[model samples]
Target: MLVIGIGFFYLRPIIPFLQSQRAEATTVNKVKAIETLQNSDEFSKKLAAAALKRTAEDVEYDPGYYDIAYPGGDLPANKGVSTDLIVRSYRALGVDLQQLVHEDMSEHFRLYPQLWERKGPDRNIDHRRVPNLQRYFSRFGKVLNNSHSLDDYDIGDVVTWSLPYGAAEQAGSHIGIIVPGPGARSGEKWVVHNIGSGPKWEDKLFDYEIAGHFRFGPIRESMTAAADTKSGATLSN
Candidate 1:
């Protein structure tokens, strides 16, 4: 009885530590299981690759309005907000979200949020707004359930979050793209976003209140073909 009591006393101190380690291992295993289940489709892979490339560029967190050209407009490469990351990524895939959003809003102006209170759609800045992008994705992309489960988010998925109440209106919302994690987080996923800083790939998937989740990838060949036909230029493969 004395020997057993001594052993229990020594083990009690490390019991919590062992439990935590076990829990962490379980989580990692779950992440790996979900990773294996990921579709790994060509479009998603391309989108993830494109977003990952953004991490290499030095972008300033600038949200100033500028009158860029239509059809394939973009803010200066060095300055952009979170939405710009999404814009640039999809643009890499030959998907002109600016044009698509502008055209859709033009015909269905009432369908979108009038938060900015503009008379009509402003192609110059509409696509750069988070709310506008959320609406666009919900309309055209597959809207996934917003949950705390890491399993729900997959590579190339787009996520949006509502910032805390005191944040500036322009900074009230944020967005990011999911991509494969780096190094130790390989079993998990990371988010690529430009929140106040330049583009980054970090393990911040659940850092904020998830407001929207979407899978908008695997661009249909017809869509790419139509874009090519309209622009009179072949999209990058």
Candidate 2:
């Protein structure tokens, strides 16, 4: 004769373990997320999806007027807007942006290496201060300098500026865009980023040594290692 025994599980007992497992799973996901980001094309759709999810992690726009603490008690505001969420979200998906940030620091002209270190609306991180960083940041604010509209943009794009001469010290040009590339404009693709206002943005840029431009994709072959770390499947032979 053969017999079999059945067992039942109580969620409470397994809940803690399940949560722990979920956290681990998220960590793994983040690892994968970072690799994906490091290797994919600048305008890759996959990267966009990963960044969007990351942006949603923080409930508040910490940099904005919204002021409410995140439920987890780690971040400051509830629904604030900070690139940290984008980075953390990548963590949830098993990714860490730091890997790329540290490896290819030169690729980014106006990199804010310590943007994550500061808090409480403090933008005093002395990043590599590119010549025209401010002009770039101004494009996304409530008052974009020459913007018509920002209806099409993603994440991981860059923007440059051409500030007035002589004032380059205090009122010089600036550029930055940890966001994404915008849609096609005048038959050419545009980029999206926050110069000072809403995240819902889009704009036009040129491919040159001057005003502004958007860039997304791997800069160095060494950094591409992140793509293979996933070990699940390879893409783009």
Candidate with the greatest lDDT versus the true structure: 1
lDDT of 1 at 210: 89
| Model 1 ranges off by over 4 Å | 1-41, 166-171, 218-237
How would you encode candidate 1's per-residue C-alpha lDDT over 1-237 as one tens digit per residue?
A: 999999999999899887655434233533442344343556776677777777778998877777777777777678788998998888877888887889889999999988987989987889999999999899999999999888888888999988887352365799999876653445587788888778877778888888999999634543431233222222122
Writing each residue's lDDT as its tens digit, candidate 2 over 91-181 gives 3333333344433343443443233344222222121234223322332222222333344433444445555663332234444343332
Residue pairs of candidate 1 with colliding backbone atoms = none
Against the correct fold, how does model 1 do in TM-score? 0.75
Global Cα lDDT for candidate 2 = 0.36
TM-score of each: 0.75, 0.31
Top TM-score hit: 1
